[model samples]
Target chain A: MSHKIGFEGYKHENNVGFFGKENSKDGKDGKEGKDDICPVATQVHHLIELY
Target chain B: MILVLGQCSDQVIGAFMHHCVKHSVDFAFVDLNQLGKSIDMDELYWFFPGQSPVSHSDITGVYNRFLDWPKQNKYQMDRLLSLFDWLDHRYENVINRPKDTMSNLSKPYQLDIASQFFSWSIPKTNIIMNTQIKIKSPFICKSISSERSIVNQVYRQEEKAFYEPALLQAYIPGLNIRVHACDDVIVAVGIQSDAVDYRYSRFENDIFMYHLPGQVEKDILALNRTLGLRFSGVDLIYHNKKYYFLEANPSPGYAYFESQLSRPYISEALVSSLSRSIH
Candidate 1:
């Protein structure tokens, strides 16, 4: 066996943020707190290997 | 009700949703990828923004089962991190709150926490941001605040990475031990192989799975209480039968347990555990 152990693909699960146009959850806060609104985290992370 | 952030249309999540439905628990999901568009660019707060001010406490918990990153793309990174913090505030009063998925997810934290109560020794590690020269051979460079960043580049030298700040840590040579801790119990431990950095590589054929020894289990379970986390994926590197701490993937991927090793029993275990809340 490769003996490559522990933290594998699934274990690295995280919350990658987004950087695009908005969708749902864009609420009255957008219309109400116009000056207070800002961007949200949506970028996803993946392994980029170099062989 | 639990709030999930990802593809409302995913398999693992879908399965989890089924559980919620079966038990009549409330849940919410927001595709941050899609939700990003309408999001404002300057208002979200980063780091600790104090306690969240969500008026409604309807949401009793949160499950962050998504693949995300940090420390890159100035325009988006801060915003995403802010979201987590925001949710932390929003869901702060929930029964099961989530810790910072990034920055806090590292092998060193796991080892450190595990060492407090367990008789285990993880490999030496370094979490540095400077890409400057001054690194020893066989060290893993990971982002303290990002997921499996395709951008994470490990090196024997610090020169190449110093230009831009990245996480650098010493490498541990040992059997990989992925232990799942829920409710302060070592629920699962499996072994694998074949990739230098499994986080960024794909070699399933070479990977194998095994149960942890009993004595080791005792030590692991004892350490679980220290984390104060309802869920934790503990990844450790083992050398000479001794475990060297790597990082604790807080919001680990459950799909691997089911998809790769066919440990679908995890779903049942989760269902059974979460069922406690249902009653």
Candidate 2:
């Protein structure tokens, strides 16, 4: 089964806003804003394979 | 002139502004987050803070990218509503008016329209809200409305009754495909992710350009036209050598897909369309 463990417990739920600007909700710096990664600070189980 | 409406921090709006500058397209940006106390609205003119009042005749088109209403004073909210009302009732050449985009609020309604185009397949789905009905195992549950929610598989053993209404859909195992149509231009990208909802996937999604069949592309364009949208992002599942239509996003965040491509096809198409004078 390709289930992502603890997906409900993650920090970012809505996957809101892509760009970051001054006083933006997503991030303070544009660097962090553009960076798309898992919000949680731990490794996750990987499943599914597509080419 | 083209009027771009929404917050400056939104990537889609930012991309439109960037393209406008790069392409020398005459345009104006109304940052919704920066609205001050009030805006003076008359039949033909609107006066925002720190700028001369703009005549309605001066705008040929409007690119609306409003996500959610930011926390605003009562005066700002009233002014925003006034603007929204005018844009819906009196405007032409709006990429999409708010009212026209209402179909997206109901996923089943959108799917009903998608069902018209026979080229693509739609998964077996149902909206369960305070009703008794038989359902199969290995199904997924998601938000019935356009409200963002992560797609999660429903275990048969869990409580069958949902506290809140949700859409239960048969889980079709396959690769995910996102097709973005900007007016007549459509771009397809295949997403390979292990996560049920690719948006929240922890692993990096393998996004690659997918060349869709000629008829499929045409039908998608037709579907967009039927939905009264000049731009949309459609979700599909490629299963058993057939494409299954999931849902259509009227206000698509195309920046993520555009970032992966060598050229910004979606944004460029939008800019080109918005740049043209309505007259």
- Which candidate leads in lDDT? 2
Candidate with the greatest TM-score versus the true structure: 2
**Model 1: per-residue lDDT, tens digit, A13-41?**
32221111121123322111111111134
Model 1 off-target regions past 4 Å? A1-51, B1-5, B9-11, B18-96, B99-111, B114-118, B127-131, B134-136, B150-161, B189-191, B205-209
Q: Write the per-residue lDDT of candidate 1 for residues B1-279, one digit (tens) a residue.
A: 455554432334544554445455554444455344432223422111222322223434456555444234665655666666655665443212345443244445555666675556655555555445666686766654433443234567554444444556666655666776655445454555455655333434233555777876666555544554555566666777676665555555544444344444555555445434431
lDDT for predicted candidate 2 compared with the true structure: 0.70
Q: Candidate 2, A36: how far from true, in Å?
A: 16
- Note each model's CA RMSD in angstroms: 14.0, 12.7
* Position B2, candidate 2: lDDT: 77
Q: What is chain B's TM-score across the candidates, in the order shown?
A: 0.63, 0.90
Question: What fraction of native interface contacts is shared by candidate 1?
Answer: 0.00
For model 2 the local lDDT of residue B213 reads 89
Candidate 2: residue B45 lDDT (0-100):
76
Cα distance off (Å), candidate 1, residue B90: 8.9
